[model samples]
Target: MSSLNIATRALTTNMAALQVIGHNIANVNTEGYSRQTVQLQNAGYQSTGGGYFGKGVEIATVDRAYNAHLTREARITASTAAGDAARLERLEQLEALFPMGDKGLGSALNDMLNAWADLSASPSNSTARSVVISRADAFAARLRDTAGQIDLLRNSTQQQVGEHVDAINRLATELAGVNRSIIETAGGSHVPNDLFDQRDKLLADLSQYAQISVVPGEGGSANVFLGGSQPLVLGTQTGKLAVQRDPLDTSRINVMFTQGALATPLDANTLGSGALAGTLRFLNDDLSAIQNQVGRIALATSSLINQQHQLGVDLAGNMGGNFFVPTGPAQGLPAPTNASAATAAATVSNPQALIASDYELRVEATGFSVRRLSDGTTTALATLPAEIDGLSFSIGAGPAAVGDSFRIRPYEGAARNLQVAIAAPSSLAVASPVLVTPGTGNSAGMSVESLYARAPSANLTDPVTLTFNADGTFSATGLGPGNPPPDNPGPPASYNYTPGQPLQFNGWSLTLRGTPTAGDSFAIGAAPSSAIAQNAGNANGMLALRSLATFEGTALSDGYVSLFSDVGSRVQNAQFSAAFSSNVATTAEQARANVAGVNLDEEAARLLQFQQAYQASAKFLQIAQSTFDSLLQTVGR
Candidate 1:
């Protein structure tokens, strides 16, 4: 090649290099901008007699400093970190509701128990009885308030899920547009570095909402997938995601893809990592479990208290009524598509045997089946009145169709409905129905350890007297006589008196302790009527409630403590997970930056190098022009 052509080629290549260096330096702080370098190559040589002549340098192409694997790793780690952080924030809020120490549900339960103990001491004191009722009301109020807060959290999470889904759809659509622009601008010859940067930024934003996988498509376009397989963007055509209400649970929100004719619900477990996944996790697992636990405590408390209260007689000489109104079961009937009119209802049979779970009752071809949602345990249903896990289910009217089903939430809203049933202090059951007393003129000392009326409705018009005989046998009078007492027969049957054994007769039991002389006698009689003032001081039944075993064999107070501890532990675990995830994301981001990030110092050095090369190329052009001028002068001479 000639000197002029060589100098021109050198000048052009140097100018392009300077422009690339300037671009890199200008975009040093731009987010998602990768550093770019100019490629140089030797121009074609000309054939000569001795050897091929050398040529000056020419510009080859401009390349971006990007690592696809590193970028993908950063995106994955960012998605995980975002999910963990979101979950941790919500769990922290939930944990704050159930504060430990004296201010929480544990203290409220203790206050209720203490009130009951004080009422047992002075059963006739109207103030003490009122305190008991007040404490119970406080306990129920606390439970209801806590449950309401949990529901609020769940609702907030559902709302956030919907918002995130909208954001994901928006970003996906914008990313597809960017992909189309990049393909058209680049035209397959060179990479559009700015457009590529814009695409990367959009992907990073989208990953925060949902896990995404990106693949290079034809003509500089990209195809993005959600949760690894679901297509979100395919070569300039985008798909949308939506949030919809769950059919079985109207309160629950389900994430779905609306790409096809029919929307398809996405499995929560299949969602790899994102804010949407975290929100669903809290709603379906953590919040649901907490609500069930609160409901379980409510059911156990009401059932046990009502049962014990019924076994005693109030100051009015009447059997104790229910202490609390039990919560009814929650039912979700089948969709209107089912032809059967058969409906199912569930009632609590044994509160102590109840589990914190929801049940699905399905009518199969052969029989009905009840499945526990928590553990997936399926039990076959028998006749109409079928019982399982303490719940008695009854089907109504006609035979159920094969596809007919019902969801039974035995304790879903129990806490919200828990309340004090009794309004009058005089109605508190704190006395035994039958009273036992020692007869006058008895020598040996014998005391009644316990006394209970076996049949509250049985008429006990006359008192029954037990006289100890010389042969250690006891004879009863006032009750009907004979081994099997006949109607209206006088006197009672005789029997051996065993120390510390309960003597049962005439629908009543009297437990006596200590040895008695032959002349010692005990009398058992009915409690006085409501008009009698002495009945107010009796607290035998109230004292017995102090050691009552309720709430799955544990004290009610202990159950609340366990629930508080569980919430605290979950919060701690969530905090740790969030921190660990953040660290992983930071490391992955640093690695990606090492390959694609622009360093101002490196760009500055390249800028100086390119400037000197441009100056040298200009000098070469000047020397070639001067030589040509001198050669022209000589030719003129």
Candidate 2:
């Protein structure tokens, strides 16, 4: 190569370098733009049968200043960090809506328990009863509100899914256009570095919406598939994606391909670790679970409260009314009609009338014969039998006239798979009564005193005892042998089977019956006589509050107060955990951005270096041109 030709090659190389440097400076602030540099090589000098050397530099190629491994790492980092942030933000919103402490369900449940206790303390106070109703109402309201908030989140997530789908489609279309341009520009030895950067940015965006697998295409484009199936993009032809409402949940959106008639449900379980995954999880899993937990709390609380309230004595000294009703499953609402309530009352008079009206009376003849259930002995009686083991029967003193019926159930072997039916519609015959001689001996055929004497020996400090005092009053304590004496000891008494009067105990009535003797003890029986005993002494309020607050009381004391504390603690803990997760995610995302963010200062420095090198090369080319021109002129002379 001659000096003039070498100078020409050097000038072209310097000019190309300058152009590359200028392009980098122009796109320094542009998103996803990678810097470029011009590579140079020495042009060889030719000599006839002599050593050859390079005269001047020639432009080899314009290359992108990017490391493939580092670029991939950056993309993966952005995808995961963005996904985490999105999930945490949604969870935080739900957590905030389900407030903890006194303001939340915990406090309302506590108020309900206290209301019950107040009602029990003053049974005649209608105000107390009203408070109970109000507190229960508050509990229900709070639960419903919390559920509504969760639903709102679900609906919002659906909208987000739609927006994300739109974003993904747009990015995919742009990527395809970039692919076409790159393939066309790369027809010869030249490569479009700027277009490659744009393509990388779109791929990073794609990863946020779905767990994508990228395949290198014929040109610079990538073939993208989601979750190992379903093509998201195909070279220069991008696949269309859309969001549709989920059939099962209108508040949620499902992902689908535009070409396909079939739809795929997009849920948290299906799409993992991306923006769509986070939103889907919030809708189908996180929000739904919280709502379910709230529902359970509401259901359990209502059921227990209603049950115990019915069993206890009310202000009028009558059995209290139902407080809460189970709104799910077993007792979902309007109580099932009882057989007794469905039948008409009997209308007969006198001894013969009792027998004649038996056919018309709605008598549930259980057909249970008397048996020493402990020993399995059967004996017939005019009255309904009480000593049967698995059999229970009730009789109507047959006063039935017309439009009356009887139901009968006979005990089967061990189990009571007995059947019942209306035996009569108008009247029916009553069984003949058998008379027996009265005796001074115990009617139970066993000493009644023995029943009271056999209290449990365990927990001796609380010795169980029975007391009978003047004016026919009575008392019993749940104490053992070593327990302390009764606090108000002088009350071994009975009721006036009381004329124009009612017995009172702890601000409530105690209606007693029959006579009592010092040594001739009438048994109080194993069961308590209090109306509250209808609840089986289980203290239903504790259960009510526990369920209301979603509090498990494995470590709590056996009382309503313990239940309240446990529920409050759990709610507070959940709120704290949610807040902490959100804060941590936010911090981590910021850190990730700092590490991978585009830096204008660094890009500028690169620009200046490449520019200066290009300028120096141009000057060298000019100096070589002048020297070559002088030599040529001298040779011509």
lDDT of model 2 at residue 602? 66
- Quote each prediction's TM-score: 0.84, 0.60
lDDT of 2 at 523: 22
Q: Between which residue pairs do clashes occur in model 1? A: none
* Candidates' C-alpha lDDT: 0.78, 0.49
What digit string (tens of lDDT, one per residue) describes model 1 on residues 174-271?
99999889878765667788788889989998888778888888666788988558888998888888888877666567888878676878988778
> For residues 1-637, could you state the per-residue lDDT of candidate 2 as single tens digits?
2655665776677677767767766776677677677787877666656677557778888887666666665555555555555666677676676555678666776676666555434433446545655665676666666656666677777788788788888888888888887777765776777678788888878877766777888666678877446677787886777777644234446677664565454444545556876666666555544543454344444444444344433322344444543232110011122333332211111111111000111223443233332224445535442322222334443342322233221111001111111122111101001111122432332222101111113241232233444544445544224433444544432223232233322211222334544322322223323332222121223332343322343211122243334334544654564456456545654454454444567656766775676676667667877887888899999
RMSD of 2: 17.3
Top of the candidates by lDDT: 1
Backbone clashes in candidate 2 total: 28
Flag regions of model 2 displaced more than 4 Å. 48-55, 249-253, 266-270, 312-637
Candidate 1 — number of clashing residue pairs? 0
